[model samples]
Structures are given as C-alpha cells and as structure tokens.
Target: MTGLVEYAERHPWLTDAIVVAALLGSGVLGVHLVGPGDSRPEDVWVADAVTVVACLAVFGARTHPRATVVVTTVCAVVGGGLGFLLTPLLLAPVMVALYWLAVTTTSRTAWTYGAVTIVLVVGTAVGADIDETVALRSVGPALWLVLPLVMGSRSRLRDALLDAVRARAEHAERTRDDEARLRVTEERMRIARDLHDVVAHHLAVANAQAGTAAHLLRRSPELTQKVLADLQTTTSAVMLELRDTVGVLRNGGADEDGLEPAPGLARLPELIEACASAGLTVDVEVDGEPRELPAGIDLTAYRIVQEALTNATKYSASGSASLRLGYGARLIIAVANETRPGDPGAGRPGYGIVGMRERAHAVGGDLRVSDAGGRFEVVSSLPLHTPAATP
Candidate 1:
C-alpha cells in the first residue's frame, strides 16, 4: 500500500491515466446496460465526452488545484443533467481534484470551493424541474468530495510534523560536534602549559651547570667533574619527564609502564638540591604540619615553586634564595631571591610567571609576584579541598 502511494505521488500523470481509463470504461458499460430505451445515441456521446474531459482535468490537479476543481465541477454538473447513468462516473474526477486541492491549498480555499461546487450542482438540478428524489440523490457525490478533502488535510499535517522532527535532530547533531571541538582545544592548551614548565626549569639548570663546568675545567678539575655529572642528570630527567608528558597526551590520559608519578610538595627537597647543584643556595622553612593534598592542587603547588626557583637561579645576583611552606586551612608557598646589582625588579614579565598564575587559578588558587627593596618574591595560596581530589 505504501509503495503504491509513493508511486502515485512520483508519477501523477500515470495515476490520472489510470483514473481516466476506469471512468471511461464504467461510462461505456453504463450506457450499454441502459440500452436504446433509456439513453439516446446523442446522450451517450455527450456522457462519454464529459467523462473523458473531466478525467483529463485531474492531471493538473497537483500543480493547479483551484483551476482543476473548477473544470471538473463544470463537467460534473453537465453530466448530471444528461441522466443518472452518467452522473456517477463523471463525479470520480471531481472527487480526485477536491482531494488534491485540500492537500495543496489552505483550509479556507478548499472548503469554499467544495461548498460552492456542491450547491451549484444540486441547485441546477432543482431549477431545471428535475424530480426532488433525483436532486436528493446527489448527496452521494457530495460525500465523495468531502471524504477526500478530510484525508488530504490529515496527510498535509503529518508531513509538517515530520519536517519539524528532522530539523530538531540536525540541530542536536551540530551541537555535539561543537562541544567535541571545544574539548580538544582545551586539552591542547593544557599540554602546552605542561611542556613549557618542564623545559624551562630543567634547561635553565643545565645552562648554569654547563657554564660552571667550563669555567672550572682546568683550575678545579674535581669540582668540574661533579658539575658535569649534575648537568647530565638534569638533562636526562628533563628528557624522561618530557616523554611522559607527551605520552599522557598520546594515550588520552591512560597510565603507561615506566612513567613516574608527577612531582609534588614532597619533592621540594629534591628541587632545592638540583638548584644547589647549579650553584644556587636555597634555604627552606616550614610553618605547619604537611599532609596529602588533592592531585591537581599538589601538582599546581609544585609547578609554582619550580617556576619561582628557576627564575631565582637564572636572575638572582646573590646566588641564594629562600622557600617557605605554610600548611594551615590553606597551603601557602613562598619563594624569594635577591636581585642582581643595578637590577630594579624581578628581571621581566614572561611565560614562567603567566604559566604559574594560570596553574594557580586552575586549582582554585591565586598567586602574586612582588619586588620589595631588591628581593623578588612569589607567593601562591591554594585551598586544601579541591574538585580534583581523589576521595
């Protein structure tokens, strides 16, 4: 049934041809059944001619619905005047045209056309002094026209609902794609920040150690060997950390063997020792008891300290710095170093400070950088409880 309906919609001409054939065949049969006693030769010819013309009008119903309705209505009225034998067959085309009009046009237009056609046909029969019984019999033709219009209206409503549903589905798909792209952009930015921290800290230390080793090579061979060893260790650690960070990006955060856990507050001593090996003496102090912290907060605190110390080692004139950790309701990390001679402030604003500020803010913390009377200081305070906590 669905396949036939689809075929009719696709090739309306074929549907019209089928309807014309049926109506012509029925008219021929009706005339023969009536015999010469009923319809004369002239009457038969008029009936057949009206049926053919009416069915042909149905071909344009889809494209020119109102015009088709007018043409077929006239054909129906003329056939009704001829005799009862021709009325039923001629009315088939009228019914098809009414259905097409309802489907293609607004309700007002279709209903108006249907009402006018019915009144004209019945009124003409009565005015001509046709019997009241025959005029009342035209009710069957009226019903045929009304039923198709109702069905056509229903079909039009169904198509509108389907189109709305399809539009909503397409909008939902586009929203999903936009969200996926946003997530990818955020992940790339996170990776870039991590890469900057790892490279900046280790390279600064390696550069200092290499310079010291070259200066002491002949006069102090023994100290030069130790500095060279520290340089090798710093560069190797930098390589390993870089590989692990990149691996996290490649594997989409899944753990891999041989990948070390990220450094945190507990690794502060090791960080200071690396600075000391690079010829920078850093004195450490703590004000409260230390406890385990949230993973994001711990990593953020470590990064803040590493960046501050790297700046101190690279720019301080005194070759010494100080670190203080205050563990209370909140964790406070502070690092300060003396400025080089004639230097006004913490050398200059750069990515290290920006990256530190970003990391602090990401973990719901805040950071401040200051230059007070030759001492360059960085202080960061983080909340004890964080969203990324492993509870």
Candidate 2:
C-alpha cells in the first residue's frame, strides 16, 4: 500500500488517467446491468454518452478542483434529469471531484460545494418523475458526496500535523549543534589562559636566576654553582608543571602515572620558597582561621598569589615583599613591594595582571593594582559564598 501511494505521488497524471478509466468502466458496466431493456435506441445512446462525459470530467479535478466539481455536478444532474438513474454510477465522477476540492480547499468551500452537489442531484431525480422513494434515491448520493469529503479533510489534517512535528525536530537539532560549538570555544579559551600563567611565571624566574649565575661565574665559583643549581631546579619544576598542564588537555581529565593534583592555596609556602631561591624574601601574615575551600576558588587564589610574588621578585628594588591572607566572609589576599626607580620589569607588557583580574572576576571576586606611595601593591578578595564555592 505504501509503495503504491509513493508511486502515485511520483506519477500523478498516470494515476489520474487510471482512475478515470476505472470510473468509466464502472459507469458503463452499471448502466448495462441495471438499465431498462425496453428503452429506445436513442435513449440508450444518450445515457451512455452522459456516463462517458461525467467520468471524463474527473481527469481535471485535481488541477482545478472547484471548476471540475461544477462541471461534474452539472453532468450528474443532467444525467438524472434525462432518466439515466438506473444505477446512479454516473455520480462517481462527482464524488471524486468533491474529494479533490475538500483536500485542496478550505473546509467551508468543500462543504459548500458538497451541499450544492446533493441538492442538484436530488432535485433533478424528484423533478424527472422517477419511480422511486425520495429518501431511497437521496441516500446513495448523499453518502457518496460526504464520505470522500470527510476522508480528504482528515488526510489534509494529518499532513499538516506531520509538517509541524518535522519543523520542531529540525529546530532542536540546530540548537544542539550551536551548544556544542560554544562549549568547544570555551574550552579553547581556558587552555590559553592556563598556558599563559604557567609559561610567564616560570620563565621570569629562570631569566633572573640565569643572569645572576652568569654575573658571578668569575667572581665567586661557590655562589655561581648555587645560582646554577637554583636555575636547574626552577627549569625542572617548570617542565613538570607544563607536562601535567598539557597532559590535562591531551588526555581529557584521565589519570596518568605520577600526575599531580592542581596547585591551590595549600601550595603558597612552596611558591614563597621558590621566590626565596631567586633572591627575594617574602614576609607572610594570616588573620582568622583558614578552612576548606571549593576547588575553583582555591585554584584561583593560588594563581593570584603566585603571579603577584613573581612580579615582586622581578621588579622590587629591596629584594623583599609582604603577603597577607585574611579569611572571613571573604578571603582577602594582599601582596606589596617597594617600587624600583628604574626596574625593567615594572611596566612590562604581559597578561599576568589581566589573567589575575579575570580569574578573580570568574569566581565572583575582584582585584586591584596600586603603585602609589613608592610601593606597588596587588589586593584581591573572593567571596566565600561564590557561585563556584562548595554548597
């Protein structure tokens, strides 16, 4: 059945021709089976002609439904008026035309056309003095007109519902694709930020240590050896951190052998030790009891402190800095160092400050940089109840 429907859709004209031939055959057969044998030769020929004309009109119903309905209706009424009502098979084309109109037109137009067809056929039968009850004559034609119209209207409604469902499915697919693309873009930005922080902080420390070792090579062999040792340590640590960071990107969060957890506030002492090796002394102070923190906030806090210490070691003239951590409704981190008159690293163009500020804002916090009163200071505060914090 499905295959036949598909074929008919593909070859509509051929399908229509086949339908016309079938109706023509039915009309001719119906006439011979029920037509009166006592009728004159001229009357028989006229009845056959009327049946042929009515069946042929169905061929044009699909293309011009309203016009075809009018033509076929007139033919059916005329056939009845001429005493061609033996089998009522001449009304087949009118049924086909009404169905076409119902499927292609509005419900009002289809119903109106159907009503007009019934009135004309029944009126013609009654006016022609046919020897039959009015209700019996009317029943067959009424069913013929109404059934096809009802079936066609149902088909139209089904097609409309299918179109709506298909449209909604297409819209949902587009939304899914857009969300996937957005996630990919966000992942790329996160990787870029991590790369900047890792490379900038480690490279700055390595450069300072290398310079010191080179300057003291001829003056003090022991001091030079210590400086070179520190450089090696700094480079090795940088390599390990870089490997872990890059592995997170390559492996997509899968655990690997010797993979360490990300650095957080607990690693601040280690950061301070690394700065001390680069000829910078840091004095630390803490107020209020420190407690557990969410992973995102903890990581953000560690990175901000690490970046500020790196800057102080590279730019301060006094080779010393101060750091304070205050815990309460908010965690406040402050790092301060004396400004150097001609420090090369004081106004260096880099993303370290920007990255810190972005990290703070991401966790519902803020950071401030100040170079007033002959001192450079970085102060950042993060709320304990941030969106990223533990529930």
Give one digit per residue, the lDDT tens place, for model 1 in 179-242: 8998898777777778888999999999989989999999999999999999999999999888
Tens digit per residue, CA lDDT, model 2, 1-391:
9999999999999999999999999888755554435453346667677778888888888889999899888877766776666344677888889889988898999999898888887787666456757677777677777888999899878888999999999998999999999989877767777887787778878888888788899999999999889889889988988888878778778475677677899998888877877778999999999988888889999999989988987888898999999998899999999988766667454688888988999899999998767788999999776584467
TM agreement with the true structure for every prediction = 0.69, 0.76
- Index of the highest-TM-score prediction: 2
Residue 60 local lDDT, model 1 = 87
Q: Candidate 2 at 219: error in angstroms? A: 5.4
lDDT of all predictions, in order shown? 0.82, 0.83
Winning candidate number (lDDT): 2
Which residue pairs in candidate 2 collide?
none
Can you give the lDDT of residue 255 in candidate 2? 70
Cα lDDT of model 1 overall?
Answer: 0.82
The count of backbone overlaps in candidate 2 is 0
